[model samples]
Structure formats: structure tokens, C-alpha cells
Target: MKRLRTSIRVKLTIATLIPLVTAIALCWVVGASIITSRFSSQALYTVETSLNSAHELFLGEQSRLSDIIRLTSRLPELAENLSTSGPTASVAPLRLLLGNEHLSFLTLVDRNGLVRYRAANPSFNGDSRIGDKIVSAALKGAVTSGITVLQAEQAGRENPQLPGKMVIRLKATPHAYTSSKTMEERGLFLVASAPVLGSDGKLLGAVYGGILINSDNRLVDRITSVVFQQGDTDARVRGNATMFLDNIRIATTVRDEQDKPAIGSLMSEEVFAAISRGTKWIGRAFVLKEHYFTAYEPLRDLAGAVVGALYVGMPERPLMQLRSQVNIIFSCVLLFLTIIGVTLSAWIGSKMTRPVRALADGARRITAGEDLPDIHVDSHDEIAELADEFNIMKHRLAIREDENRALNHTLEQKVMERTAQLEEKNQQLLAAQKELAESERLAAVGMLASGVAHEINNPLAIIRGNAELLEMTATLDNPANEEVETIIRQTDRIERIVRNLLTFSRSGIKRLSLVSLGILVDDILDQVGHQIPLDQYRIVRNYRDGEIEVEGDEGQLRQVFTNLIVNGLQAMEGGGMLTVETSLNMAQQQANITITDSGPGISAEQREKIFTPFFTTKRDGTGLGLAISYGIVTDHAGEIRINGEVGTGAVFTVVLPLRQKEVDELS
Candidate 1:
């Protein structure tokens, strides 16, 4: 049991190291799949982008060369010299057209797809026929342009000597000579055909133009530069483009170990099969025993036949090296964290046990009522916290023990002194209490008598003096207005006392009458702002239908309006707006008087019992305003409701019947 308890270091090792190992394993398992999927997708995107670019370049060359052929085919020499001067005499003009352009193949062919004039290989003007699809389409007066692979023997040149590019031409129908060489094999060429017409649009002959791509070409080199060119050599994004004829790479920028053009090399079996089936193959491929991110697109001929493939690829090594470097960094960081965690955990475990053991021993000593010394711990860890707590407890215990010893020594003297002090204080307290009792009795009687006499005699004195002053100052013709005002003020002071006592003491049966809400509200506002400045609040009056009359007691309704408006104004500190809106709801035939204030609103708890009798939130309040208001509203066959939450100020909505039909019938 001791061994198990003490082996915290081992426990920490197993606890920390296991998760690290699991994490490493998890990273190893998932990292390859994620990296491969993401990097491969990026590589394929680049390749596909390059392939589409190549297709555009190919079409551009065809279109530009087709325009040249159309312009050339309309020449008067082309139609006149074919029969009179014969086919061989036109080679100079055809070669001149090919001179200023990058065109590789330009041949004057009759409508039957027979080559009449050849610019490059002009010496072999034999009666050789061509089965080139673009030429055949041009023979039918259809201008065509496309990519096609020609056999070696058909061009009368060796495989390496073939022009590595081609394009079709456009022309009208003329004629074809019966030829002998019909089954000759040819190398790859992109060709264009255009119909040649006389000045009057009559079919004359068709012109065929082509560029050879069966050898290393500048077109593919430029494509490679444009698509995958990057500045970094160490992490270079190396790319190669190829013109593939079905399975064989006819012309490519892909290089062999001898730094020769990797021409005539076969595409991978998988890529070839997919391309043969007209599928675009984009994935990782092993070319020249090195992996590449390759994209292959099926090349279609003039007749829309799948004849070859266009390919673009970036070397896979750089991407792989990037992944490997990332993996190495991750492993180094993981190892560093694991080592740090294990070292920290081990140090903590070793340091922890000693303090815990010391604390346990100290706790045992404390249980036996033995003195304990301070426990010292320097590390900033949980173990140090525990030690600190123990030290604090030990210090408190020492203080208590010292107090106990001192208390034991001074107990008898303390009792004697305390008893003497208590007796003295008791006699003094007894005399003080008797005098205090007499004072309290006299204070209570004096306060009551004084308060009653002051309250009653002051008002009576004011009334008597004001009356005497009025009597003395009055004249038959002229009355002293100041003396009359003093009399009126004294009477009002006495009336206020009576009013406060009588209000809400007993619920008075309200007298109902036809009342205009606007008139009642106006009267209350004029009376209430006597002390307060009315300009402190913006009074917004919105009466939807003017002069809304409700059947209610005039005095009671006035009191309700007075209480609500005063309360609303008082609720707003530093002045806020007050909205008094009246609307007659025709559907319910009730008058709604909404008195709202932009004030620090009533809370939920305050609103609940706001109308409860004698329930007030104010320091000096009668708490009878809303209660009396509620009673009056109910008696008038109306409903008074306060709507709003804590923050949105209070809205006291009084909904009263236009004519209290129920109450009126009863009356």
C-alpha cells in the first residue's frame, strides 16, 4: 500500500506519456490522408488549369492560320495557276504565305483531298492522296479545323523529321487528282481547312494548312512557362506539357535523364485507358520512374473522334517534401511538449509526496495536542498551496493555545474586576435609567402636546390673523387683494389637513357624469405644475379622435388624472417627456386615455401590487393615490392598467366606456 501511494512519479509518467503516444499515433494515422487529399487536389487544379490553357492556345493558332488560308485561297493565281501553270508552280507562293507566319504545313489541295502543293517538302510532288478529315470536310465546302496524328510514311519523312505541329485550312471546292499513296502512316498534326471560292462565290478549290507537333515545339514550352512558373528553385513548381496521340507522347516538354525530349514515350496504362474512353484523367502518375501530378484531357479530331490527349504535369517531389517538412516540425514540437510535460509532471510528483507526508505527520501531532512548526514549501504548485493552508492553520492554533494559557492565568482577577465594574455600572445605569424614564415620559407627552398644539393653533392663528387683516384692509369700493389672498391661503392650509385625513379613509361612492377627457387632463396639468415648472417635461398630446367623452364622475376622474400625471412626472429625474394620448375605440366603444412617461420605470415587483391599498415605494407617501384611482376607475365602469417592463418607463392606460350603459341602466 505504501509503495503504491509513494509511486506518484510512476503514476504521473503513465498518466502523461500515454496520451502523448496516443496523440502521435492519431496524427500519424490521419496526417497522411489529409495531406494527400489536400495536396493532390491542389496539384490537379494546376494541371487542369494548364490543360485548358493549352486548348485555348491550340484553337487560337488554328483560327489565326485559318484566316490566313481564307485570304490566300482567294488569290487569282491559286485558281488560275492550278490548271494552266500546274500544281508545282504554286509552291513558291504557298511558302511565301508560310514565311511571315509560324505556320509549319501549307499545301494547295484539290477538293478530293489530294495534295497539289507542299511548301516544306516541295520536291515530293507525287500523286499522293491525303485522308486528313479536315481536308475531306473542306472538299464538301465545309471549313474545318482540328488536331490529328499523321503516320511517318504519309509525310515522306522520318518520325523525328516530322513537323511537330499542324493546323487545318479553309477553302471552296475545286477538284481532286487520282492518287496512288492512299494507305501511308503519318505523324501528329493540328490542321485547318477553308473553302476557296472564285470572285463570284463559285466553289474553286479547298486550301489545307497544318502545323506539326510530333517533335519538341515552342508552343508546349511557352505553355509550361505560363502555367507552372514560380520564383523558388529549392521548392520549384516544375511543370511539363505534352501532346499525346492516343497513348504515345508525340511532342512534350517532359525531359528524359539524358535531357532529351521524352518523345514517343507511352502514357501510363491507367491514363491511356481513361483517355481512350474519352475521360479526363487527373491524378498522381509515375512518369520516368518519378511521381508527378498529371492532368490528361482527351484530344478530339475534326470528326469529333477521340484521337489523342493533352497533358500537363507538375513534379510531385516538392509537394511531398513540403508535407515531410511539416511532419518533421510537428513531430519535433510534439516530442518537445511530451518531454516538457513528463519532466514537469515527474518533478511535481517527487516534490509533492514529501510535503504531504510532513503535513500528515503534523496533522497527527496536532490531533495529539502537540505543538506544530511551520511547514515550508517553495514551489508554485498545489502542494505549496496545501502547505500554506497548513501553516495558516498551525499559526491560528498556536495563537489559540497561547490565549488559553494567558486566559487561565488571568481568569480569577478578571472575574473580580469584572464583578466590581458591573456593580458600579449597574448603580450608575439604574440612576441613569430612572432619569431616562422620566425624560422619555416627559418627552413623549411634550412632543404629543406640542405637535397637536402647533398643528392646530398655527392654522387657527393664520385664519384669525388673515380674517382680521382682511376686515381692516377692506373698503366698500376697493378690497385689499393681498389681505384677501392671505385669507385664501390660510383656508387652503386648513383644507389640506382635512383632505389628507378624509382621502382613502373611506371609499366614497363616486358621482358619475359626462366628462371630456381632454378638459379633465388640461385642468389637472394646470393645477399640478403650480410648484414645478411645466417646461421641464415635453407634454405630447395625441388625441386620435378629438373630444373623447366618457361617462365618469368629474371630480374622481380629475383626481385619477392628477395622481397619474404627478407620479409620472416625479418618476422622471432631471426631467423627461410625458405623453398623454386619448383615443376612442369604436369597436369596444371605450375611451382610452394613455398617460405614459419617459422615466426610470417601475419594476415588476412594484407594478404587481402598485394599486394595492397602502402599498407605496416612496419614503413619504400616503400610498392611497393609485388605490383611490383604481377604486374610482372601477366605479365608473372602466379599467385602469399600467403596462411596461422595468426599463421602458410606465404607461398607465385608463380604458373607460363611452357611456356606462350598464351603470346608467342601473342608475
Candidate 2:
């Protein structure tokens, strides 16, 4: 404290070390950040690309099966055998092809959607596949292929070996959705179907085959081979590929602690939920007992419903090891450079001390107002350069001061722009919330309808049963006979209404059959008198020369046509003409049934919402009739069209496909 003398060398040393240490720290921090970001990005990209590759492989399997089935269906000999001797004669050729193609199951179905032959079990035949989506589509002249989940019984029916292979023991998994079952007995298959057509272009039948994917490692191994290309002896260092049926791993290349394929292990709940919502999940996730960078894409059915997921993941350990190595190398380099910097700073500080003392002495002389010659340094050094740079630094500092003010002004404008963007985001959030609310409302409605239908069905069945007993017990000429009959009829109507509600809620068709549209319309017309007062209205029928038949659920089609006919009759409150016409569009192989009502028509807005559930114009209407009808027609691969303006009366047209064969006696 005598004078607090600080040497120029000390000052110069501090100045040199301050910026050197700061720069080294910055380089370390920035370099680590860049390394981590690049590695993470590359990891994510690799996982996503692997997922895409796995998806293509899955599709490639389906395409291969599709080609096989399509080519098999085009065989003239198979078609001739099917048409002449039926599935019995065609089995030999099919069995040979089945073995050649390595299919787990191959079936021949007639145009009526009935399984006529089974390559796996020749004795098992004549089972109806009318409810099978792939077979039904194939019968309708479409070649179809997709990943399908089959019930254990259905899989066993295809091939007895399939059930055993499909059975996977479920293991306890972390962060996965829990299942009530201990094992997944159902089979997941890559299935393909094609229509067997005659030389004249007529649909003869359909041929369908499938390869079971449960416990199959070939596809996932192929995906890994193609995507990773690195044949590592260590399984942990290799990539993982999995195909999930919902949340269950039906096919996978990932292994468990026992070194067996984790076939039945479940995926994380977060990934499952994301894929369930039809969104891709790409990020780090915990798989099994380890963390991994994963990418998952939803695997959809032919109907576009998210049925499962395709997943690819890289082990986090390898990536972490790489990052750790990079960091270690950086740290070592940083430490070495730090040591060198300190040594150089010490040397430079010693060199500058002499020159700095000379400058100090000159400054003191100038301050004392002593006239002196220009200060001279013997060597060209940093101190000599600093003397020349002082005036330029002063000018640049002023320019930076002005730039700071302009930057502040620009930042304020940017804040305003950001505020506007935030407002727009808020508006988007509100819209999304509104959509969510609407979805919730629809879900609630479905639950209510289902509950109501269930609660009403038991009492309804009892009432209808008692009413039928009373009708049967009473004499035909008795005074109470008509009343009993009416009671039974009215109870039946209530049952149909309940059925409509149940169908609308579940959106399912119970059974499929060949229905004659003309006969169905006539039957509804004959029965309409009991339900509606048709005394004031004139009904006209314009049916084709012959009955037009279509493949559908008879009861569902009855409901659809009855609803349309009844709606047409009721629309004419003032007693107008109701016309029903049926025709065939041979080119499209479709039947068109048109119902025209000569009364007030539907408005454009109402028409748009007409098929939507719970939207009705009538005061006493349940608003589920058209909705149920629409679902039924769509399930049957048909459509309902309304073509009429306000005040012009509504014309309802129902288009349905013609059945290629008689499906009534298929069973």
C-alpha cells in the first residue's frame, strides 16, 4: 500500500490473458454446441431415413404379394377351372403356386364372396368371406393389398401353422401402454387380393393370399441390411427396425437381454399415441431399457385407418460415445492451446515491458509541456502498430455508437412484428381448440347413442316378443286381433329405429347379401301405408325390365331404401306425387334408384349438412336416419345423392353396385 505500484508488464499480461482465455472458452462452448447439434441432427435424419426405408420394404412385400395374386388371377386356366369345376379343380394349380410363392395362406373365392378353396386345408371350403374387406373389394374388380390384422381363429382357418407362429409372449415393458392380455395371438399379415376375371372381362371369382408377419424377422432384417449397410458383430451398435400391430411388436429386429427378438414388446405410449393420431414421431425416446433416437410412421389399412406403426431407431449409446469422443478431443486441444497461450502471453508481456516504459516516459514529458522529438522504438512491434491504430479506433468507435442506436430502433420494430406473429398464433390456437371441442361433442353423442340403444334394446325385445305372443294367441277374426297386430308392428318400428341408432353410433354393417333393389323398393312401398298416411299422395313406380340386384346387407339396405321412400312420402305434406325409379348403368356396373318428392325441397346449406348425423329439418325426426343410411350405403360401396333446390322438392338418388354373383345361398 506504500504506492500501489502496478508494473506495465502485469497490465499487459492481464490484458493478453483476458482475451485469450475468453476466446478459448467461447471456442469450446461454440464448438461443443455445433458438434452436439450436428450429431443430433444427423442422428434424427438417419433414423427418419431408416424408417422410410422400412416403410418401403413393408410396401414392397405387399406389392410383391399383389403382383403374385394379380398375375394368378389373370391365368385363363385358373378361371376356366373355377368356372367349370369350381375351386376343387383349381386347387392343384393354386397349391403349386402357393408353395412357390411362399405364402402362408392362399384362398380362392367365388364372385359371391364365399371362400371356395383353401390351399392350406383343402377340406376347409364353402366358408363365406362376404364380410372380409379384401375379398369383398376383389370381388368388386379391385386389386387390393395392405397390412391386415387377423383374429386367431381366422388365422388358424388360413393355416394351422400361422396360429402357432403368431403367438408371442408379451413381456413387461416400460413407458408402454398396458394390455390386459398376456399374449398377442392375432396374426399380422401382408395380404393381397385380386379378382379372377374371365376372358370376356366378367368377374369369375377372387384369389387372395397372405404372408404372416408376426415373429417374422426377414423383412426387418432386410430393412436393416438396406438402411444400415454396416454388418456389425455387436447387436447393440446396429440399428433396430420394428413393425407394430397397434402397440405390439409383431415384427422386429431389436433383441432383448436374452438375445431373442423382442417380438411382443410394446412401444412407448407417447409414440403409440402420436401414431394413433396419424402423426409421425421423430425424436429421442426410451425403447425397452435403453434410450434411442427413433422415427415412427403410422401404418394404415387400405381404408386409411391407422392400424399399426413402422419404426426405426438408433441406439443412443453409440451416438453418445461419438459425442463424448469429440468433446474429449476438443477438451484436450483446448487445454493444450491454453497452456501455449499462457506461455506466449508471458513471453510477449516481457517483450512489451521495455517499449511500454519508453512510451510512458514520452507521455510524461508531453504532459509536462516539454518540447520533444518524435518518440522512436528500435524494433517494429505491436506497441509501434498500436500507436498508429489509436486514431482509427476512435473513429470506428464513434461509428459503432451510431450503429448501436440504429440497432435499438430495428429491435423495437422486430418486437412489434413478433407481437403480431404471436397474435396470429393465438388465433390458430383458438381454431384448433374449437375443432377439439367439436370432436368431443361428437364423441359424447356417440356414447349417448350407444347407451340409449343398449338400454332400449332389452325392453324393446321383450315388448316385441309379448306383442307377438298376444297376436299369435288371439283369433284372426277377434276384435283385439287388429290392435295386437298394430302393437307388434309399432314395436317392430321402434326396434328398427333403435337399430338405426346403433348402426349410426357403431358405423358397422352386420351382414352382406345379394339384395334385389326393385323388390326391396316394392316391399317398402307396400309397407309404407302402415307407417305413413299415403292416402293423399300419388305413388309412381318406374322399374327396369328385370330386378337389379346388389351386394349389401339386406336389413341395412332395407333401412336405407325405406328411409328414402318414407322421407319422400312425408315431404309431400300437401299430398303431392312421389316417384320411385330404378335403372342399371351397365358401364359402371351400378344400380341407380331415384326417389323424387313433389314438395318443398332442401336448401343448399341444409343439403350440405343433410348426411351429417343429428341434423334434421323435421320437428319429430331423430336426425339419424339419413346419417345411418349414408353409412350403410358407403359400407356397401355406394352413395346417396340429393339433387333439388329449395321449393323445387328433393330428389334422392341411391347408387349401388350390382352383384357379380348370387350371394344369398353362399353359406
Candidate 3:
């Protein structure tokens, strides 16, 4: 056992080395982490910035195309030639402008989008371009310019060399989804179209010109020169740019193993997905079998559809090499410091542990039942002071050991008594909280009732008085008389609602009277049309053979049933059945009233809090109707329950004793 254990000097040496080595290791880890994160962040930012530049350059080209077409369409000589002479007469000026602008095709179309003059092939000029977005937009007096795709036949008709120039054989690529297509024949173009209006602003025709993108590396090479120009020779080719028609590359500076531009290669599947969704992808991606920090942004046509993508990528190898160099230098420096620290720590531990060894020897002797005197040391420092204090501690420790035994016993008893007292106090506190909540709820109801009654009564009185005077003066045959009666009726309904609110605020049933559930339901049903339009709802009633009477405060009971009926009507908002069923339980001498609504029923979690004060699912509910009804029913020695499941609708059932005498007897 002793052989397995290490000495204090060894422990101190290891402790000193642990933190020093840990701190050095942590420093290396943090440095490497920061460097790696910074490199990644900077790489993405650079590629994204390059992508922005490419987009601007692409837009600038489109703007230049639009400018050329605009200038050509507005020329007086060309317009006059087309308006007076044959279509062939205008072909001379169009051909001159098309060659000067280096455009692949230039043509003039009539107001119906029919080709009238073709600068490239004047004889082939009767096709309709009305189906094309650019042509359609321009013919409607708009000057539109953007990327657009042309079919192979259309390109062939415009220029005999275009179909051959647009053909590109697809090449297999790593990290790209395999496609069955072997060749891309559609031509992607930067096109601009403008309306050719006459001197009087009349639509005479339209003019459009474009440059083919497939097999043309000029645009992508220009983007590379502008974006990667600041870098060295090696870095110049490290950053590449590409233009893709969908996922297939039409033009690119990215080269394959043969050092040829990989124009027909497909983009990585992940990048294709992002571009397809009209979003930008910025991260590390494998392009042409080499990893690069790349950014791909969707290229949209004039119709705002994602027809292709634009990409810019920077090589990740250079940044990774820099990070490797930094790590190598950092590790070497830390290794040198660690070697020096280990040597110094061993020497210091040996010197400091000599006195400590002596103390250990003394303790061992005491443990072996041998009496020893005070420990002494030669050094006049804290180590020497420690020896004197150690002797005093040995003497005081014996006396304190006995005192602790008694103190521990007394502490356990006090803890038990305090725990019992805390449990009792907790119970009292819980009871107090419940009472306080109820009191606060009552106080809020009283305040709301007082404020509402004060604010609405004066205005209601004025309205009612004016309505009565109008009712007296209006003739029986007057159409407005019916509207006047409706106003007076609604005013009375508002007064009754206010009275009910004041009663609910009191939180009790003040008087008891006989209420016929069947008759009461019918009366409220007849009056509910004033509350809400009932054209969409179907009312259903199933009453017992005789009237079922209950002894309750008539006004309070009326409020309860009215609230339920109105709630049922509101719930079936899209037009469903509102069912009122009343039955007498002869065995229990209780009357049962049920109001069912074909509405989306309440869930279990909602049912738990359905009758809680200020809890409601309605958007604009005050959340007190059910709570008030619950209180009134309980005061009358009655029970109210809700039964239903989600999607089946809810049924609210209220059961009351047949008479007040029966309720008293049961209580």
C-alpha cells in the first residue's frame, strides 16, 4: 500500500506541472480554434464579395445591351425606313448597328410581336416572338433586359452559327448528381428588348438584340481578372468564376485536369439545390474535383424565375497552408517553455519538501505510539513558524475533538425541530394564498361592474328617450318605424345585461322564484335574433312532456341560460345545429337543462380551466360568464358540467333541484 502511494514532494511537483502544461495546451487549442474560425469567415466573405462584383458586371453588360437597342430603335432614319419603305429597306441600318455592338442577333418586330426585319437573315422574318417574356413586355411599352434562354431552332433561325456555338457535351464531375442528358443545346443569352414607338407615341414595332453565353469564356474570364487581380500568379487562377444554365455550366474559368475550361461540367448537388430555391449558397464546396470556398447565387430571368446561377470560388489550400505554419511555430514555442518549467518545478519541490519530510516523520512516530517533543527547523522563515504552530495544533486538537462530539448531537435535535415548524408554516401560507386569490377576484368584479354601470346608463337613457319620441311621431306605414322598434328593443337588452352584470358582481342569488326551463329557453331563443343573425343556424329543441320548473332567482337563472344560448350560437359560426334539451329527473326531483353546440369542442387541458375566472378561449371574451354561472349554480345547491370531446362539439348540462325546499332538505 505504501509503495503504491506517492510522497508529498512528488505530489507537489505533479501539481505544479499539471496547471503549467494545461495552460500551455489550452493556449495552443484556443489559438488554433481562433485561427481556423477567422480563416473560414474571411474566406466566405471574400467569395461572397466576389459574387457581388460578378453580379454587378453582369448587370452592367445587360444595361449596355439595353442602351444599344434603345439607341438603335430611336434612330429617325431606321424608323422612317420601316414606316415608309419595305421591311428590307430598314435591314441595312440594323445590320450596321448589330455588327458595331457585337450582338449575336438583332431584329425588329411589329406591334403584334411578329418579326418584321432581321439584321442577320432578312428573309427569315415572319415568326412570332409574342410568347417570349422580353418581347411580350417590350410590345406593352416596357424596356426589359435580363438573362433568357432560347430554343435550338429559334437560335438557328436567328443565326446559322448560333446552334453550333450553343452545343456543349456534358462532362462527369465529382460531388455532382448524375444527369441523363449528354448535351446542352439551349442557348443562354444576355438579351435586351425595347419598344419602337413612332413620333406620335404610337406602337410601331419592337427591337431586340442579345449575346450568346454558351462556349463564350469572355465574361467569366473578365470576372476573374477583376475579382482576383490583386493576388499573385498562383492565386490568379486559384479563384474561378462560372455562369450556369440551371445546374449545367455554360461558361466558366474553372479548368479540368487537361487545363481546359470546364464549360460543360455540372455544379455540386448541394449548390444546385440552393440555386434552385432562389437562394445564395456560401461555404466550402468541391468545384472541378478541387475544394474551394465558393458562393453561388441564383440567376433570375425578367419574369423573376430561377433559370440559372452565377458562381465565384476561392482556393482553400492557401489559407490552410498558412494555418499549418502558424500551428507548427506555436507548438515549438510551447514545447521549449514546457521543458524549462518541468526542470524548475522539480528543483523547487525538492528544496521545499525537506522540512515537510521532517514533519511527516514526527507524525509517523506519534501514530506508532511514541511520545515526541515540539518539531524544530533551522530556517528562519514561514517553514520554521509552521513547526511551532504544528506543535500547538496537536495539543488544541485533542480538546476540540471531545467538544465537537457533544456539539454534533445538539445540532441534530435543533434541525429536526426547525423542519417540523417550517412544514406547519408552509401549510398556513398555502391556505392564506387561496383566500387572497378569491378575495381579489371578487374585488375586480365589483370594480368592473361599478365602472360599466356608471359609464353606460346615461347614454342608454338618452338613446331610449329619443327612440320613444321618434316612435310616437313616426307613422305606422313608415319603413323607418321597424328600425326604430329594433333600436328600442336593443336598448332594453343592453339595460338587462347591465343589471345582470351588477347581480353577478354581488356573487350570490338574492331571491328565489319559479323558472320554467322550457318557456325561458323559447323566449330567449325568440329574442336572440336581435343579438346575432340566426340565418345560418338551425335551432333544435327537445323538451319533456310537462314543464320542468326550478326554484332559483329568475333574473340570475335567466342570465345563466342566456349566456349559454348565446355562446352556443356564437360557437356554430359557420352554421350548425344549436340544441336545447330539458328533462325532469323524477327519482332525484331535479331538472336538467342541456345546451349543445356543434362546434369544435374543448380539449382535456382546456376543460380543466374552462370555469376558471378570467380564462377563456374567445378572442374578445371577458371570461367571467361561465365562472359567474358556476357560482350561482353552486349557491343554489345545483351542479353544472361539460361533456364532450374534441371535434364532437360541447354539451353544457345544468342540473337544479325541482324546488327550494328540496335543496334545503338535501343540504
Q: Against the hidden true structure, what lDDT does model 3 obtain?
A: 0.81
Candidate 2 C-alpha lDDT tens digits along 215-242:
8889888888888888785666688888
lDDT of 3 at 56: 93
Clashing pairs in 3: none
Report lDDT per candidate.
Answer: 0.70, 0.80, 0.81
Steric clash pairs (candidate 2): none
lDDT of 3 by residue, 154-242 (tens): 88888877999999999999999789999999989999989888898888878898999998989998898898775554433488899
After best superposition, candidate 2 residue 378: deviation in angstroms? 9.3
Q: Can you write out model 1's per-residue Cα lDDT over 89-158, one digit (the tens) per residue?
A: 4456777877677566677766455566777667555453456667767767877777766665655431
What local lDDT does model 2 show for residue 549? 84
Assess candidate 1 and give its lDDT: 0.70
Ranking of candidates on TM-score, top first: 3, 2, 1
Question: Which one wins by lDDT: 2 or 3?
Answer: 3
- Count clashing residue pairs in model 1: 38
